[model samples]
Structures are given as structure tokens and as C-alpha cells.
Target chain A: AQRVTQPEKLLSVFKGAPVELKCNYSYSGSPELFWYVQYSRQRLQLLLRHISRESIKGFTADLNKGETSFHLKKPFAQEEDSAMYYCALAFTGGGNKLTFGTGTQLKVEL
Target chain B: SAVISQKPSRDICQRGTSLTIQCQVDSQVTMMFWYRQQPGQSLTLIATANQGSEATYESGFVIDKFPISRPNLTFSTLTVSNMSPEDSSIYLCSVEDQTGGDEQFFGPGTRLTVL
Candidate 1:
């Protein structure tokens, strides 16, 4: 069974501080990881994928096969960055199915 | 990116009743999925809505309890039958990006509260 774990239920940081949302996965095969964000009153949207290796909104995540972790990171947190972040994993031959982790509520204080 | 919409954005229903949530996508998509988000929990995939065929349900999800229909590529519906208070959750529909990048675009979910 493929499982994604996000340890933090809530992460609070002041503006301009660095932010890191931890995520780990348990999958046997090669896994593709992604980060999704949902702002207040907005629908869920894709933030970035590991395969792309591109940063979105100053957020970046690297897939660590050795540690089985794909943590989201941002250098300077902005007040507008407050939202719910979800880490998801998909494996080969899974038919595009995604296993999501319990989201982390990021509250960036002014 | 696809524009997705869900009907009956929020509904309060009595126990034993059923509520059908409709999902519509602006463009045709090959794979559509239904998900449930319980209060304070992560989103769980319910099933994959296959066009012109029966939906493929995930483990622990049964067709009898959550019936899904995908008559076409752009539309799908999920019905929660014999609802209970435990069924209170936000049901969302999403479409896989046609470019095949494994990214999914989600619709504004339908919030159901059963009392």
C-alpha cells in the first residue's frame, strides 16, 4: 500500500521567515510526489510536482529516495502564503491515482 | 488548466436521505475522480469516473454506498446513498490534466452535512 505522511498538522511562521512543511511517503516503487495548495475560499490547485523540478510561488520540493521524503520549502514566507498544503504521491502503473497526506495548515503571521 | 464546477455547493440533509453531487468540466477529460474530505482529515479518493463505463472504486469504497456515473468525458456525478451523520464531508471532483503530466484540477467541493 502506498501512503503519504505529513507530520505537522499546523505550522505558524512570521512573515519573511523560512517555512518547511514535512512530508514522507511509504511506497515500494519509484514514486512521483506533488504539492497542492488551497487558499481560503479557493479550490485546491497544484503547486508543484517533483518530476517537473520547477519552483512555483517560490516553493520547491526535492524527492529524496533514500529518506523517502519530499518536503516543501520556501525561503521567505509571505502573509498571502497562508493556506492548506497537501503532499501527494503517485507510483508507476497506479493509473494516475494519488495518495494524499494529511494537510498542513500554514499560517503566516503579519 | 480546466474549469470545473460542482452543483449544490452546500447542502444540509436529514439522515437516510440521498444527495447527488454533479461535476462538470469545461473541457473533455479522460480521467475524472471523486474525493471525500472529512472535517480535519486529508482528501481521500473515492473512485475514478470512467467514461462510458462503470467507475473504478478505491479500496474501502463501494459502489452501493457511493454510486458514480460518467456518461461522457466532461461530466460525472456521485451520489451518496443512505446518508448518515458520518457521511458529512466535502465531496470534490477533479480531472486529470489532458497533457498527461499527472496533475489534477479540482472543482469547488460540495459540502454535505447530514443530521
Candidate 2:
């Protein structure tokens, strides 16, 4: 079974500070990791994917195969960056059903 | 990436009643999924909706409580029957578009609250 684990429930940081949201996964097959963000009163949207290797809104996540981790990070946090972040894994050939981790609520204060 | 839409963005219903949520996609897709996200929690897979067949439900979920319908490639519906307070959650529909590296596209979830 493919599983995703996000260790933090809430992370508070100040503006211009660095932020890191930890995410670990357990999957036998090659994992396809992704990060999704949900802003207040807005629909959930894709933030970044391991395959894309591109950063969105100054946020980036590197998939460490050896560590089985895909942690989301940002160098400088902004107040508008406050939102719920979810780490999801898409298991190939498993009906493409995505397994999502318990989200981390990030609060970026000014 | 596929564009998805869901109806009844938010609703407050009494216990013992049922609610059917609708999901529509801009393009045709083969695999449509239904998920339940409790308040401040992760998303749980409820069932997989495929055209021309019955829905495949995940563990701890039954067809009787969450009946699903896939009328076509671009649309699906999930009905929560005999609802209870515990059923208060956000219901979301997603698509695993094979063309888009199977990246899942999510719909604007339906927020259901049971009294």
C-alpha cells in the first residue's frame, strides 16, 4: 500500500523567514510525488510535482528517493503564503488513485 | 490538465437526509474519483467512478452509504445516503488524466454539513 505522511499539523513563521514542510512516503514502486495548496476560500490547486522539478510561488520540493521524502520549502515566506499544504503520491497502475498526507497548515505572519 | 467543476459548493442538511453531489469535467476522462476530506484533515479515497461499470469503493466505505454514478466520460455523481453528523465533510471529485502524465485534476469540493 502507498502511504504519505506529513509530520507537522501547523507551522508558524514570520514574513521573510524560511519555511519547510516535512513529508515522507512509503511505497514499494517508483513514487510520483506532488504538492497541493489550498488558500482560504479558494479551491485546491497543484503547487508542484517531483517530475516537473519546477517551483511555484517560490515554493520547491525535492523528492529524495533514498530518504523517501518530498519536503516542500520556501526561502522567503510571505503573509499571503498562509494556506494548507498537502503532499500526495500517485501510485502508478493503481487506478491512479492518489494517496494524500495529513495536511500542514502554514501561517505566515507579518 | 483537465478542468473540473462541482455543484452545491456548500450545503447544510439535517441528519437522515441524503445529498447527491455532481462533478463535471471539461474534457472526457476514463478514471474519475470521489474523495472525502474531513475538517482540517487529509483526503480519503471513497470510490473510483468509471464509465460503463459500477463504482469501486475503498475500504471502510460501502456502496449503500456512498452510491456513485458515471453516466459518461466527462461527468459523475456521488450520493451520500442516510447522512449523519459524522458525514460532515468536503466531497471532492478528481480525474486521473492519462494524457497529462496521469496528474490528478481536482474539482471545487462540495462542503456538506449535517446537523
Candidate 3:
């Protein structure tokens, strides 16, 4: 079974501070990790994928195979960056099916 | 990326009733997925709807409880049958990007609140 764990429920940080949302996964096969974001009154959208290795909105996540972790990080937290972040894993042959983490509510304070 | 839309953005229904949510995509997509998001929780996939095949349901979800229809490549519907208070949640539909990769585009979602 593939599972994703996001340890934080809510993370509050002041503007310009660094932010890190922790995510860990348990999967026997090679994992395809991604980060999705949902802003207030907006639909959920893909933020970044491990395979792409590209940053979106200054957010980046590195997949660590040894540690089985894909943590999202940003150098400076902006007030507009406040939203719900979800870490998802897709199975190698599971046809793009995703198993998502509990999600982290990031509140960037002004 | 695909443009997706779900009908009945939000609705409040009584228990024991059924609500069918429709999802339409701008372009034909090979894979469409239905997911449920409970209050303050992450999205959990309910089933995968293919164009001409029986929908494959995830564990803990049954066909009798949540029936899905995929009559074509660009449209699908999910019906929440015999609804209860626990069935109140946001139902979402997403389509895999046709261009390639594992990226998916999501609809606004149908918010169902069972009374």
C-alpha cells in the first residue's frame, strides 16, 4: 500500500521567513511525488512534481529516496502564499492514481 | 492542461436522498478520477472512470454506494446514493494532462452538505 504522511496541520510564519512543510511516504516501488496547492475560493492546482524538478511560485520539493521524504520548501514566505498544501504520490504503474497526505495549512502572517 | 467544470457548485440535501454530480472537460481525456475531500482533510480518490469500461473503485468505496458513469471521453458523473451526514463533503473530478507527464487538472468541485 502507498501512503503519504504530512506531519504538520498548521504552520504559521512571518513574512519573509523560510517555510518547510514536511512530507513522508511509504511505498515499495519507485514513488512519483507532487505538490498541490489550493487557495481560498480556488480550485486545487498542481504546484510542482518531483520528476519535473522545477519550482513554482518559489516553492520546491526534493524527493529523497533513502529517507522516503519529499519536503516542500520556500526561501521566503509571502502573505499571499497562505493556502493548503498537499503532498501526493503516484504509483509507478498505478495509471496516475494519487494517494494524498493530510495536507498542511500554511498561514503566512503579515 | 485540461479545463474542467463540475455542475451544481454546492448543494444541501437531506439524508436518504441522492445527488448526482456532473463533470465535463474541454478536451478528451483518457483518464478521469473522482475524489472526496472531507472537512479539513486531504483528497481521497473514490474511483477511476474510463471511457468505455467499468469504473474501478478504491478500497473502502463500493459501486453500490457511489455509482459512476463514463459514457464518453470528455464527460463523467458520480452519484452519491443513500446519502447520510457522513456523505457531506466536497466531490471533485480531475483529468490527467493529455500532453504527458503525471500532472492533472482539477475542477472547482461540488460541495455536498447532507442535512
Q: What is the lDDT of residue A10 in candidate 2?
A: 97
TM value for model 1: 0.97
Query: Each model's fnat?
Result: 0.82, 0.74, 0.76
As a whole number from 0 to 100, the lDDT of residue A53 in candidate 2 is: 94
lDDT of 2 by residue, A13-89 (tens): 99999999999999999898999899998878788899999988999999999999999999999999999999999
Interface RMSD of 1: 1.0
Measured with DockQ on alpha carbons, how good is candidate 2?
0.74
**Count of residue pairs whose backbone atoms collide, per candidate:** 0, 0, 0
Candidate number that wins on TM-score, 1 or 2: 1
Q: State each model's TM-score restricted to chain B.
A: 0.97, 0.98, 0.97
lDDT of 1 by residue, A1-110 (tens): 99999999999999999999999999988788999999999999999999999999999999999999999999999999999999998755436788899999999998
Assess candidate 3 and give its lDDT. 0.94
lDDT of 2 by residue, B6-43 (tens): 99999999999999999999999989999999987899
DockQ of each: 0.84, 0.74, 0.82
**Using Cα atoms with residue i matched to residue i, what is each candidate's TM-score against the true structure?**
0.97, 0.93, 0.97
Q: TM-score of the B chain in model 1?
A: 0.97
Error of 3 at B110 (Å): 0.6
